[model samples]
Target: MTDQSKHEVQFFTLHGKRRAYVKAGEGPVLLLLHGLACDHRTWLPVIDELAKKYTVIAPDLLGHGVSDKPRADYTLGGYANGMRDLLTVLGIDKVTVVGHSFGGGVAMQFAYQFPERTQRMMLVATGGLGPEVTPLIKFIQAPGWFPAMGVLTLPGIRHVETLALRSAAAYGGGPLRKYTRDLAEVADILESWKDRRTRFAIRHLVRAVIDWRGQIVTMSDRAYLTEAIPMAVVWGREDQVIPVRHASNAAALAPELRVEVMADSGHFPHKDHPEQFARILDDFIVTTEPATYNRARFRRMLRSGMARADTTLASVDTALTTA
Candidate 1:
């Protein structure tokens, strides 16, 4: 069991709504963004260790944790703007933005929208890289699923559901063992849905990015922008939620991207191996130079459209040859 006492939850009001977060340690700022349906607590596994070397600011993004769930914008752009406003109010000028799953999409948007404020970006099993996603996410976008979820989480029913999930995640072996970690994360998400507001926020948020087929939004159109930012991709080789192959999609877009696949881990690689995750992240920060954005170059990339396929492939080949 995690020692929750180590994390002191704090609150701040933004645009009249109370937002909850945990801020700890001090040094270069690290803005940790949690995935959809999760709160700041999801980072508990590595936050303390990370905080020892850097100032870590992990917020329950607007609608998720103890933050207010209003009829507000949940789009990626809105989330990026929210991060900017939050950092501005806190007097944090820049950050090494780190995001997980949906939070990864937010990290990319934050970097794109405010490159000057983002020194580097780290994506962990993030979305917007490709169209493939677990069927469960797609199912949530299905019509009537919200109300059905409501029924599933009703009073006594939720207890049984939670127990079943935990049992299966813990003891269900054979083929199911591969997805045990993913199942555990799903159980946590379901537990949060007991709150009506959380369910509403999750529904709206899911619909915004996912569809019946799979993910509707993608970063491929703007992937060339990675040239201006120091970025890294980390994915669990066994990740069932977002396929680990998406890491290659990111590498294909920008060959400079450092892709680390954690074997035997699922969607939550950090959770599966917190020590290794922290070590990898710390090494990345120590080795890579933070991005320095130039307005002229930014304008040039925008005007040039996506980098030519041949040029991008050549760069990939060159990076491989050099490695």
Candidate 2:
């Protein structure tokens, strides 16, 4: 049986709605957060492999997978708090949080909100780091596009999509070929629009972070607060959904961010190189010391020249460690 099949999804009720997730293995806790229009299933490629050494918990955020589609809070902070509640129920406090694309934003929020519980962070082609994003995403979250999406997501549209691609390939020139190829990248995303719940979720949830003009809620300024956490960033060089340059931009903002670029992959590097992704994540977790966040010290850093850390890493006490 495949790793995907081996793990059975368990359900956890939050706010009177069920959130489906897969919980497996034993050891240090590791939470895998999926990107937009995705569920915990996205982690199946690396789940069992990484579960060998760590307790891996991958959840279907409030609206994505088998989880209930309630018109609830789907913002990063909301997602982060939901994760904390899940961890609390399982009696797992500190964890290494790994997020991909949209999940990356949630991971950062998780670290910021509950620093003491965040052991480390790993972002894979994370979103909400910059203003640059796919025109498709920008348009999907646009104001006037909501009503159009209703018609666009009609079940028959998928058949139309296939026919259009075939026609483009058959009769069209270089320009149409390029358009079709680009459309192919997001074809699955488009297919997902057929689901009314998914469409609603994507429309509402994405708008919370993104606007018609790329991403609106950027976390660049908050990078300084992560000085104490060991972080890694993995980006696909060919990521068209979110540019690879955002990885460099994030590295510039965050201190000691270990950025790894997957040359051959596109938007989903973890799926492209699951074994390597798992290896990179395992190495980081095993080698680095987990960070602890003290609320008082966290506040102090904001006040004490955040521009330059005249202060060292802060622990439970006010004492500073010059790491």
Candidate 3:
């Protein structure tokens, strides 16, 4: 792995708003998207390694990270449009998108909305596969959740809360070990929430996709579109937030999906197993051909949509192993 500290975040302005991102290395483009409440830093683990061979562009999504967070669109489709515009401004034509968690939903939407610009897709512990999600996410939808966050971020209280979470994250053994990283991540998220604007933005973003019943949006309906785009889905076997089972759902919907479940990893596979994650990603890009968009074929699929709906999901690979 290369020295992550050496990678500096660059900024760009779009629509009069400033956005922060990290661009490194050179070659074919690889657009890395981080999960909710996380910024481009989440990709630091594998960014340098991947950057060695590919031009890696990891952006802090509009509402997350240091990006300007105003009263702007935060829906999945809105996010997809934002990515397309960003790519346009950067003068990039096509890319193999890599998205984690909420970013995964945006990746799928990006491909769906602008297939011509998408070369391939790589999803990590992605959302929008199913309605099942962790209670922690659902709890955000609960009334007073925003107010509660405000209280938690109070000066003295914030320090104590972050300290407790960090302590739990440092525990070396027993069941807590399995969730130590998650605890640490939660602490980081809490720290970020100390900024009132970020808290407000996150609230709107979460409400747009989640509800009491879990994730309200999904990619299952359009999974058949993968026939025109090569996609690989990576998930941690023990991902408590999204659950590894969701990967099975995705594979079932798109038989062509390359599924890999990392053992002993939770939600953040790239963080827990950076080397393996980078290797798998590099190998996939090397082995699979980038998708070439054909207008006629896309049109036929769109025309045959309802008739072929039931036939979309043909088989299942419930086994949590590399495809």
Q: What is the C-alpha lDDT of each candidate?
A: 0.86, 0.79, 0.85
Tens-digit per-residue lDDT, 1-323, candidate 2? 11245689899786798888899898999999988887787788899898898999999888787788878888888999999999998889799999999999999999988898998999999985677788877776777776787787677877688557556534655534433433433555666666788778888888899876667776655677778799999988878788888877777667587999987667778877899999999999888999988778888867764545443323201211110
* Residue-wise C-alpha lDDT for candidate 1, range 1-323, written one tens digit per residue: 22363778888898888888899999999999999898888889999899898999999998898899988888999999999988998999989999999999999999999999999999999998877888988887778888998998887998888788788888988777777766766777887888888888888899999987678777776788888888999999989898888888888877788999998789989888999999989998999998988999999988774456445545643433233
- Clash totals for all candidate models: 0, 0, 0
* TM-score top scorer: 3
The parts of candidate 2 lying over 4 Å away from their true place are 1-4, 160-185, 305-323
| lDDT agreement of model 3 with the native | 0.85
| 161-216 per-residue lDDT for model 3 (tens digits) | 98898888777457666667577788888898888889888889999999987788
Q: Note the residue pairs that clash in candidate 1.
A: none
What shift in Å separates residue 217 of candidate 3 from its native position after superposition? Answer: 0.5
Better of 2 and 3 by TM-score: 3
Q: What TM-score, over all chains together, does every model reach?
A: 0.93, 0.85, 0.93
